[model samples]
Target: MSDVAVCSVVSHKFVPAQGMPVPGQVPASARAPRNDALRCTACSMRAICMPQGLTSDELKRMESLICPSRTIKQGETIYRANDSFQNIYAVRAGSFKTVVMHRDGGEQVTGFHLAGDSLGFDGVSSGHHSCDAVALEDSKVCIIPFHLLEAMCREVKAVQQHLHRMMGGEIVRESSQMMLLGTMSAEQRVATFLLNLSDRLRMRGYSPTEFHLRMTREEIGSYLGIKLETVSRMLSRFQRDGLVDIRGKDIRILDHEGLVRV
Candidate 1:
């Protein structure tokens, strides 16, 4: 069988599509059907993934360049460091964390990706991935081959502009993260992290005030450039101060303004 077909069969239970109810919202047996067909225009992530100002015909053309969406199970590596840069991926569902291995043989978590986020931009200059993209949960991603995408960008003005904007956004995000790690205190860093996650979740139609964390404390600390113990302590302090309610991995922001002040 074809690789795509095999992937579809293996991930039939969790194909990662829009409108799938989040965990705890409904029983698995009661969830709605998933759209297995890989059509860009029909995808719920169309707005986030597609180039701005594209017509339906243009979207169809863009879709034709993309390969079938592939599922990456939790803890699976999407791409390893130094892998050849052939394609960039769009998160169709779930989240992923990217890590860079240090010279000392330790690894540093560089960033976390959620649905609608783009991955593999780091390989643009070096022609190979600088970090590893690993799924934090069972996830799906639509693969956009780089060479075809580049050719299309030349023909489509909007597509080129969108690609530039995505690259610019990545630079800005990296700069902000460096500032956060270099300047912000531990509490401030954690506060910013929560607020950022909340904002991103809100954009995705999820409740900003309440949600479950996909990454563990160690992973979060690595991304934030802090110690795991410090993360735990700050979270406990936040709960004690009535800023949030934490139950295992679930978090509810009880006092958004209070958190903002921290």
Candidate 2:
């Protein structure tokens, strides 16, 4: 594969994560019903996130408070390393990945954010971003002017709690990544990544065990701290062992327990 093919490119055909309605198309009956469109947007993460505590009026106010920017093309940088932080960005659509470069010229993927995921939290403290955020596909983001969101959070208890919880979650995720890289064998790392992806997809309201890979095997290997050929070999082995099914970019976990035992 070409080096360019290994890099993630955000495409217009990208689907939004769960909790977002189909973009730009609304049923005629939806217009007359008492059903609020934002509720449809709030289908997931209702109990644990900032959107949950906001009243309809507050949400409307939030919509107006934040400025909507044009969709970012795949591979476009949202912000580069050392860029000044001006706004707290919320992913309104599509996905993003953060990359940090090492002094040795190696690249480490810090995290991947899907729709409704919050970015810019780290920048709040650093003032300048430590990593580069690039769109995985054509994506929309809402720029919540930092000053406005800061003031609102001071007044809203739920928003404060939500931010705290999100930060805590970040710590946990990083810790999990460390464990995966430090402890797991190549086969185990691949298995764990498969499980992790399945969990994340399920959280996004997709099939947990069966889905397409958004990131390339090279990217996967990079993130997991392994060689690309090792990733490919292990995957081939998994397929041969009847633990997984791989076709094109699509993957299906045929034996969950067997995968765990890898």
Candidate 3:
């Protein structure tokens, strides 16, 4: 299909829900009939994911320029390390984990992205993606052609500032992750991870204390610089201490104060 004809975003608004790992079951929302939407303005994630203070003219330009939303099922990759960087994406539904391969031939997860996140900036400097963006659930991402976005930013001060803020946020997040691996104990890492997830969920209008973990323990361990066993052990310990309840991937933070103390 022509890019212009498919430019309207497909309505794939994120709604937090999960269940047992069953292969045949994809999200009902993923299977829903595609409805052409008004690009950025119609997106439910706009408040958290898009630039602020866009004038009506700029917004219309954005809606006109955006490419079609792309669907990626669980375990599918939206982009991989070394692919030519042409566009960035905004999370419209579900979540993703970005990973890079180590020289030892293992995947080292760099980040877990959720609804309202913007991705693909890692390639801006090099013209190729440095990591693979693998969907953790059936997902959709609104593709923004980078060349067009750059042109818009050059003309719109608000848009430029928003891009700067996005870049700054990513820098802070990576710095925090480095500190997490170097300074924090296993227990503290686990607690801090849960707290951070809870905080992000709260920001996205989900319950702060309860949510399903989309990434598996092995993936979490990769991100935290811990082992799969250590990840399981930490969670078990937290459950025993009444800090959290974990049933497979489901996690409920029971004691926010106690967890912070850990």
The candidate that achieves the highest lDDT relative to the unseen native structure: 1
Query: lDDT tens digits, residues 1-262, model 3?
Result: 0000001112232222252112233323233333476466777788987778888877666665555567777776777888777777888889888888878777888888998888899999998999888788788887666776787789989888888988898889988988898999988988889999998888889899989888778888878889989989999999999999888888998899999999
> What is the C-alpha lDDT profile of model 1 across 1-262, one tens digit per residue?
0000011111112233453323223323123232347677677877877888888777667766666677888877767788777678899998888888888867688888988889999999998899888787789987776777888899999999999988988998898888888899999988889989998888778799999898888888888989989999999999999999999989999999999999
| Residue range 74-113, candidate 2, lDDT tens digits | 7877777777776667776677777788898777777777
Using lDDT as the measure, name the better of candidate 2 and candidate 3: 3
- Candidate 3: where are CA atoms >4 Å away? 1-35
lDDT of 2: 0.68
C-alpha lDDT of candidate 1 relative to the true structure: 0.78
How many backbone clashes does every candidate have? 0, 4, 0
Per TM-score, the best of the predicted structures is 1
- Of the two candidates 2 and 3, the one with more favorable TM-score, higher being better, is 3
lDDT of each: 0.78, 0.68, 0.76
TM value for model 1? 0.85
Where does candidate 2 stray beyond 4 Å? 1-5, 8-49
